[model samples]
Target: MTPRPFSGFEWLIAWRYLRARRSEGGVSVMTWISLIGIALAVFALIATLAVRSGFRSEFTGVILGANAHVTVYAQTYNDEFGRPTRAIRDFDGVAERLQAVEGVTRAAPMVRGQVMLAANGRNSGVEVFGQRPADVQTIPLLAEPERARGDIARLADGVAIGQGVARELNVGVGDKVTMISPNGVQGPFGTTPRISHFEVVYIFAVGRYDIDRTRLYMPLSEAQTFFNHQDTVDEIEVLVTRPDDVAAMIAPILDATGPDYFTWTWRDSSGGFLRALEMEDNIMFVILSILVLIATMNITSGLIMLVKNKGRDVGVLRTMGLSEGSILRVFFICGASIGVAGTIIGVVAGSLFAIYIDPVFGFVNWLLGGGVWDPSVRFLSALPAELRWEDVAKAVGLSLGLSFVVTIFPARRAARLDPVEALRYE
Candidate 1:
């Protein structure tokens, strides 16, 4: 008749009821449904997070490789307006000084100009970039693994054209192309539009249509002479050891430049894409979490039904002096057990699938005739999956929290059952 003694005994009986319910005819169906729901929901969430993270990581690499981590340009409203007015002196020494900065890995100067590329009477507007061969190869990580080539110093009057540009111009390596600049050269009579020709020594296909179609790279001297910039540059590109440190690294360089130039990071150049990815992640998390919540609600319903079916047992236990707290703990433990088992299964399934997603995508790509993850059309060259422990932990925590909270209603209802009414019920 002791209430305290009944606490331990009530839990023992509660556990038996929980285990016994699995064998009950209708209860097993509902239990399996609830378990499957939680497992599938958690699995989907984890897998989706991994793929999204992979996309961001790989695309960021492409951007970093194609451009510098940080760019220092003349501080006018725009580079075009400021190029003539601003003076960027000591550029050669600037690269060495920037290398001494804590985070900077390398620095280089580049001349940028807008010009028309003409070949065989076919013309396309392009952006020409001029860089010293040594500096060009040093800053951005541009290695043609497919070609097994080491450096791109072969780009003398040589040029690397994008796949799109090459197709449009019908040009290839060893072809001659002419660049006509709108910036005219000084003449005895007046300024005259200048035309310069360069031989394409090497070609690089970065898989970005906009970059490939509109970009052309050549030696720094040719670009300067062609653009009429005898001893000045359009911008300075700095590569950093850690991309995350780009903003912090800019402060000292900006101070060194003494406000004559403005520094920009890759994040600044590609803000729109980065923000889009962030928004997508948030949306996916919210949408997927709702599924787990819906599954938890199912668990709540199943537990409530079980409590009703076992009303007589609960009433008899109360009559035997079981405490409400003990009754509540029993039901809670039962529900939590279901959640834990489902979560374990889901975590295992999700991790395995995420780890193999890249290979799966590659296989799919081969099956689809090499078009599953087209770098030419899509930002990501292949399916990417990046598993983060933090994401997994968040999912587990969410599942557990939802599962525990859902048990409260059923647990409380069973604990508060009236023994007298329940004992009289047939």
Candidate 2:
């Protein structure tokens, strides 16, 4: 009776061939080189994908957490004096209507202005956001207790400064900060710059260098007074339950706010940057896939050499009643075994590296004596690595697919070896 495919004898023969010593003209050294090459390639692919995923997540999180998902701006229209005015007069009513919209979590009216801050004999320019105390606490990143210093409760009575601003101005919570606005009072001669003092009621670090260095939060009432807007607001900041769904919510948002108001989503604000990131991600994957392809080529070379070295064995096996399919299975198993083992090793190593990236990065930074990554330049305080199962799966599929495909050519050559010629050479 014919035996089943991949029987114990076939496995035993494959194992014996793979375990052949270098002195016996075996391809042992080449096999090891191929294995290591595939492993390193896979590891690199996985690690890079993880870092890319993590950076995108962190970047988007910062954008959505600290800022509004959508902003509503009133159209510029002629006032009683025929001068164009862009301020929203009925901001409270507008905000209330926006809050009633489905998917909208909150709508807060705000005044935004550029101002120079002076304290401790240092001066720094910053963008000041005037928001209600209650609304200020609703910010996802700032509301974190560990990320914030001092009381948010005092935001109504004082201003909340960013960590970088506090550091630059050499001021802390409860310290007085002087703000000078360019849009000051209009006098007979010209407009004089408005200067005002506010206590730093809170300090926050959102892990973004640009925002941390140039943002200041003040009470809505105080901001209105400081900016010379008695009761009007510059815009209404809207937060949604799902920021990614902001696009679909735009029509409803416009319906609620009327035709005179225009809406800007976070995607509109950062679309270019996000698109660049996505493009980079695809390019990197393609580049690294080339690397994986090059690495898998080693398996082909190793198996070709193995087939050449085992020519005499193939002749003897055929004479002993072994079929061509059996010979093919034997060499196929040899190549596939190496591929499977290497892939497993690579996956384990890459996953561990991604999962413990923080400590590993810290160690490397320590060895380099610090400053391996700059938050000011990178916009994130730490190197991020987020291992996604789908990315990992894609990598595995690519590696194994290449390995199996390359092994086929060499396995077929071994199976088709002319027993007469092989035995005559032996």
Candidate 3:
């Protein structure tokens, strides 16, 4: 049996040191604090990254859902003459040509402009989009028939408002709202906004404030009449078969629409929101990584203190034929044990917290009594979490790697203990 292996004994001693109480010359208060700190740092980093990833995912889906993948706008959106000089005159033909383009799943004409919505003695600024309700492709993702309290089919004859708008105005389906177009007919009276009232045939919730709180749908003919633009359309909305292929699909779409038309993807028109999210995620990662780095340093300090406390043990072990290499191995096991345990627990706890985030927030809201994740104030009704294995892997790897690297200093110091000096004091 060769009296068993020295590695096994070293691990045995390390495990004992971790489990021993202060009365038995075991792990100190600082060691426990360091262990807990590292675990918390890992937890915070993992949960925060998950939150950021979830936001990006939610926002992207909302953007893609509420709007077309690509839009072929006239050369210039508007001209100084208060007229859309490049308005698509041949809307039907342009839509037909665009639909024939490769990668284009669907094409339809759309009109959008800012308007003031007044209902139930309340007024709110709103964005109006004119489209034929018969074309299901152009409707918002959350504006499905299941969620609507009124008839979505009436969009062409009446108006469809968002849930937020309905709430703010305290109006429901069958209510009438006045829509005043900002771009109205110019007259000698220095221009007056064109106002029209329509029955609120539908109320939608797009899960986005910009669209839900400020968006309305009307019939193309009504919009044309109100905006004083007839026999033409503002733009052509296009849906792509594959969202990722939007950039590639651009060339063919532009060619099909002719040089007179300008094509813009959803990403292009998101007002730099996509780039801002990426930048925010990067910045947050770096900031949280710094916190994690500080926590890892505690492992080194704890190991150093443990080595200083166990100097006499090293001498006795060396006298019993233990080598300096074995001494180093013992300390490595001690320090690495804490790191490994903390990392494992952190991963499990953090993952569970992130994955079940909805329930967690629900509990919080219940305890705090509202204001936890209000949809009116928050983009989502509950906190969103999208856990990425890559992020978890990076966090675990960094913690374990740093723990290993930190052990070298204290382990080397313990291994260098002079047996003679250590024994003379005893």
Candidate 4:
């Protein structure tokens, strides 16, 4: 007898077989294993992506807050440490020209230099930053009142110190500190290091190990005189209307300043940290995604078991002229259904878990008699879950795609079954 071609009804048969199996056996051990694997893989992918996104977002925010969106430094502008100097002089209204560029929100010249901070007989290398009093507030990471002084511009020798620097030097408000610049003065000594004293008006803590302990803030005029860089700034720190447009804004600044100036965005400045974050997320996602792959394997096994049990039906269908493609589709549909269902469940489950990780951690912290805002162990006192939609989309897509891929071989095997051989056993 000529076998019949498989039709839509054959898919119904496949589904019915799956349903019957579930009703009678209520998910075989293999099915359970597959389900667990898919669930775990989905969970891990979502969680890893969320964490990576969160950490990156948090760190980026901190960095941008402390730094500018784009920094334009002198090309030859070397420090007093005997390097070729970069010129950052009046580019004939270059700051205004940059501010006119599309996506540019604010542009300001920043004076920065290296200086030795001396307090209470202890001295440390510090980066002295000079900024406009009003514009300083616009930068991302600065805490309110960190520059507690009324106006840095008016204060001749007033300065601000980081908490870490203060603690180490045992200096505080009303204390006097002397800053020695690497740039020397050519007076009677014919090239002696320029040193100046300033009164510490306020102390601020940003909590960053690098910035908090090694930064000092002073007026631009004081810094210029201290460094002997008259009418020139080390760089121009720009604030953009949108962070993503940092690169777009850079071109104009670079063009206006000419090639002699080095223009860079925050991404350029924080590339190492960003790369590390991406690597961590990728490693975690790969590790977690394995769970899904394993689950898909289980699904494959279960479908194979179904094919063996339903050999008689398959034989009958084959005798009825079901094509190999139709047979393959039937089994593929069955296996894929299992994977799809598990992936859906996992996506929802993992997202909820990530969203509430902080609250859960808080409860645990409370139970352990630890303050939620403790600044000792964890870099951040509270838990933060930064979920990006793109990450979620990627996780779900990978899960679905893997599930589909795992079904292919099993489906092919089912399609290739010989009707006579299958029926002989039945």
Candidate 5:
């Protein structure tokens, strides 16, 4: 009687063929090579996807945590002196209106000035932001006790400096620093530079080297005085409940603040960088897919070899009333078994690596005497990994698909073996 498709006997015969001894012409060796190749490829793909996801998440989190989701700038116009001036004279009213808008969490009127900071015989140019102490406390990064040192309540008493700036200026809490601005006093000769002194009462490390290295914060009153703005603010910084929804909030925000003010979202400022990241992610996925394909090609080579070595067996089975379809299924089972096993192994390994990436990197850094990750250079304190289920599914599907597709030609060749010629040779 003809055996049912993929019956017990088919599996038995396929497994027996796979277990062929090494002395039987190295079929098992090739199987191991194919299995290892596929496993490593899947692992690499999963690990890369996890890192990409994590990096994007961390970068965006930093951007939103340390800065406003949207900034509303006053329209610049030629003054009576024909010089361009941009300031919101009704900043408090506009900010109160913006805070009343739906989805707005906080609306802070702030003064921003570019100045040179000098302390301990060291000097660095930095951007200074001036806001109320209450509003300053709303900054997520600054609110973190671990990331920020000193008192937010005393912000009006002095100033808050970034960790990198403190390091550069060799100053800390209660230390003195002088700020010099080019937009100081208008004298008969030209514009006289304005210089002011303040004590640093807080220091924050926001993880992004660029921001940490060049940011300082002062009380709004002090900043307005220093920047020569009388009862005016440079912009109104608005924070929303969901930063990702800032684009959708533009209309409501404009309606609240009136048309005299134009809004700039975080996306508008850093959109190109985020787009570049997305493009890199897609390119990386394609490259890794090619790698998985290459690894699965080994399945083709191993199956071809297995078919050649099992020719005499195929001939005998065909003579014993086994149809060509049964023969094909038998060999298909052999190749597919390796693929399934390898994929399972790879998924487990990749998931674990992503989950425990920090400790794994710690071990690696220890092995190499430390310094594997540099926050100053990478803009993150440590390597990050976020395993996504969709990425894992994609890897599994690609691996198994390539394996099955490559097995077909070899399985068909085995099924079409001429019984008469095969047994004649035997």
Candidate 6:
């Protein structure tokens, strides 16, 4: 009797053919090679994309921590003070309205101005900013356990500076410094610059060299008096619960401030630098996909060899009434099994490797002698990696699809064989 149509006999034969020794028509060597090649390709593809994502995440976190997720500025048409710079009037109401918006965690008014920071005899131009005592502590990643945390509320008459600024000025905690304002009041003598002496209270170690070099923080009330804005603020700094949600939060904030005021997110301030990095990542993903494609090509070659070696067996099976479809299923299973196994191995290996790549790279570096990455030139001390599950799924799907497609040609070739022609020399 003919065999049942949906029986698993074809799968059993396919698996047996795969396990057969080289002397028995199995391409055993090629099978191992295909498995190994696919694993390397998957590992490389996943690890490469993960490292790029990690770098992007690191940059975004550092930038957002140092800056507000969004900033709002008011453009005043008329200012009683002739200073070219304008201030947002009635900012307390604006701050309250902003705090009420959904997703906005905090909204604080700040005064920002250019001031000269003077040490013993040396002076450096710096940007001075003023925040409320409670507000000052909210700056992102502003403090680290490596450095001692101090109370900004106690800094009633003191200034907080970045480490780079302190180094450049040769100042330290408790060292006295003078801040000079260029926009001074007109006195009986002439235009006199406003000078104020302050004790250094806290030092912010914000990792980024640029932020550390030029930012000085003080109380908002003191900043208003120094900048001559008694009842106004330079701008409103806003922090959202999620940095990624800044784009959506901009509209509601603008509604609260009316048309004259404008809002900008971190994306707006970051400009092309961040956008360019994203483009680079896309390019890398495309480039790495080629490696996986090349690896899948090995599956085609191995499957083709198996078909050629199994020609005599195919003729015998056909002569015994095994249909063309059954013959095709057997070979299809053989090829697909290899592809699935390799893809699974790749996903598991790639994920583990990317997650701990820094340590792996460190070991490799040690083996090859130190200085593989120069700290002076590279911003990150270690390689950062972030594996995305979607990426793994994409890689696996492409590999399996290619494997199944390659099987069709070889299986179809075997199905079309004439029993007499295939078994003539058997």
Listed in order, each prediction's TM-score against the native is 0.82, 0.98, 0.90, 0.72, 0.94, 0.83
Least well predicted 10-residue stretch by lDDT in candidate 3: 137-146
Tens digits of per-residue lDDT, candidate 3, 1-426, equal 234444678899888777767776666677788788889988988999899999988888787777889988878656557854767788999899988987787797877788889987899998878887766435558455225677786776688888888998999988889887767778898777788889998888766766678888888888778877678888888989887668899899988878888888987877498899999999998888888778878888878877777888889988988888888888888888878877887788889989998888788888999875667676654467899999899889988888888887899999999988888978
Clashes in model 2: which pairs? none
Runs of candidate 5 with Cα error greater than 4 angstroms are 1-4, 80-82, 188-190
lDDT of 1: 0.77
* Model 2 per-residue lDDT tens digits across residues 1-426: 677889999999999888898777588888899899889989999999999999999889999999999999999998777989899999999999999999999899999999999999999999989999999899888887237788988888899988989999998888998999888999999999999999998999988888888999999999999998899999999999989878899999999999999998999999899999999999999999999889889989988988888899999999999999999999889988888888988899889999999999999999999999998898787888899999999999999999999899999999999999999956
The best candidate in terms of TM-score:
2
Best-matching candidate per lDDT:
2
Please write out the lDDT profile of model 4 over residues 1-426, one tens digit for every residue.
Answer: 433444567668666766664545334556667777788778877887887777677677667677888887766655567777764778337778777777777777778878888989998888888865555555555545334423333334488777777878888788888888757867775788877888887677664557667778777677777777678777787877777657767677677666667777888878887898888877877777776677677887887777777667778888987778788878887778778888888888889878898777778888988875544454443456777788889888888898888788878987888999988855
What is the Cα-based TM-score of model 6? 0.83
| Model with the higher lDDT, candidate 1 or 6 | 6
- Candidate 2's C-alpha runs over 4 A off are none
Q: Which whole-number lDDT from 0 to 100 does residue 137 have in model 3?
A: 30
Candidate 3: list runs displaced more than 4 Å.
1-6, 76-84, 136-140, 143-147, 182-193, 372-380
Return the clash pairs for model 3, or none.
Answer: none
Better by TM-score, candidate 6 or 5: 5
Which should have the higher lDDT, number 2 or number 3? 2
Q: Residue 121 error for model 3, in Å?
A: 1.9
Candidates in order have lDDT scores of 0.77, 0.91, 0.81, 0.74, 0.89, 0.82
lDDT for position 6 in model 3: 49
